[model samples]
Target: QQTPASYYFTEKKAAETRIQPRQKFSHKGTFGHALLVAGSFGKMGAAVLSGKACLRSGAGLLTMHVPACGYEIMQISLPEAMTTVDKHEKINTQLPELDAYSAVGIGPGIGKEQPTVELVEKLLDTIGVPLLIDADALNILSENRQLLDKLPAKTILTPHPKEFQRLAGDSSNEFERLEAGRQFAIRHQVIICLKGANTAVILSNGDVHFNSTGNAGMATGGTGDVLSGIITSLLAQKYPAEDAAILGVYEHGLAGDRAAARRGQSALIASDVVEYLGW
Candidate 1:
């Protein structure tokens, strides 16, 4: 079957246009503080990766909320980020003051425990700023469909194919899935960063911007967390939701392309993408 040509293209230059040079006199407070809720007992790496990427992506300050067990790991691995420990050792059950952070990114390694589910609900109720939802949070939304309407306006959701399938039901082909994603975004009044191939950014008004960066080398673990972090950082920097999704996705894929060029597709890992995120 033939696929329709995309009318919207996320050009590399356009993404670059959105990145403004920082003022030398500005303090860290000039950029926004990003709150990241991620990781579990065994998945502490996710928190580290996301936090690191957020910092590298130019967020002024980053606070990582992880399970208690990941405290030492997060502190040692990513000293640039401040760490907050959840009461639970393996999964988060508590909520934090949402007013402090300019933007919040959740999920990553978060497990789908009942307490975490409750935590997600509480977050939806409390978060007033931009939010980036991914991984387990996406899973939580897929399972608990009732929470869909509760999301903050212009919330960004990053989901791969299988994950999107769970949220919007399966489609027979990529073209069909893309259409489903468009409808899903419009129905939910949210931005969908459908990650894969040329990652598609679907807006609530039904516009689809296909990213031209990225390669097969990025098909590894932790990359999605990196993408989420980048998007969250852009949000913290005060990019509008639609612009953030489009630019972040383009830069993420561009970084992936750079990583693949240097390390080759088979050798590329999520960290490499973060390392190659050259502004």
Candidate 2:
């Protein structure tokens, strides 16, 4: 028989209660610094969205590492973030020194160039802090299957249906796909956020927690990048990997739900979700 929904599903009440209120005595340094490696020649918007969402989600500091071509755009669009320029004028060809940041989120808008692939490999081999991988970084992994074994314990990977399929292979249906995702998470010792209507946050130990928030309006582009930022912010704040994924997914969807309610589904965009982030 199929596992009971209650065993794996998460509800809004649980999410609401789990969210910790900021302490009045807390300073910016207490929240944590986040590093985001994102953007490219034509995709600087992704970096801007991710960086803005990261700050809005309570990260104390954010540094956006982008290709040279995106430097001006990032500076203009998200003035609050610090910038690190890559030598490549278009695609990311290098990773910044990681020791300074509390956590790192990568792969929003980064194209799958060979150098970019190498950067991902290097990140897997060296990054010691909590890491969250998304967008093309996940795609790079799909293409370079051998790197799977190098992933650090509890690294978070956010993959939509198509991306998950590429990494884990095809399944006959949703149920089969979920099981495939769970198995993949266990096998790799990673967490998987299988994004959809109710995104499933699958822990490494095989617990599947389906988010209770979010609306269909969130299907727009750049939303996933925003999620990567929020989760990375939580990770930087030192929430355990499982808590970060669960809380991040819940809050991301909740923001989408709020945006949808205000603007209506048709008018809701990824930026709207960012604006609606209330916590």
Count of clashes, each model: 0, 0
lDDT of 1 by residue, 1-279 (tens): 332334488776877787777999988998899999999989988888888888988899999999999999998999899989999989888888888899999999999999999999999988889999999999999999999989887999999988899999989998799889888887788999998988999887778888999999988999999999999998998989988899889888888988898879999999999998866
**lDDT score, residue 111, model 1?**
91
Q: Which ten residues in a row have the lowest lDDT in candidate 2?
A: 1-10
Whole-structure CA lDDT of model 2: 0.90
Query: Whole-model Cα lDDT per candidate?
Result: 0.90, 0.90
Position 202, candidate 2: lDDT: 90
Model 2 lDDT at residue 169: 95
- What are the runs in model 2 whose C-alpha is more than 4 Å off? 1-6
Residue pairs in clash, model 1: none
Q: What is the lDDT of residue 76 in candidate 1?
A: 95
| Lowest lDDT 10-residue stretch of candidate 1 | 1-10
TM-score of each: 0.96, 0.96
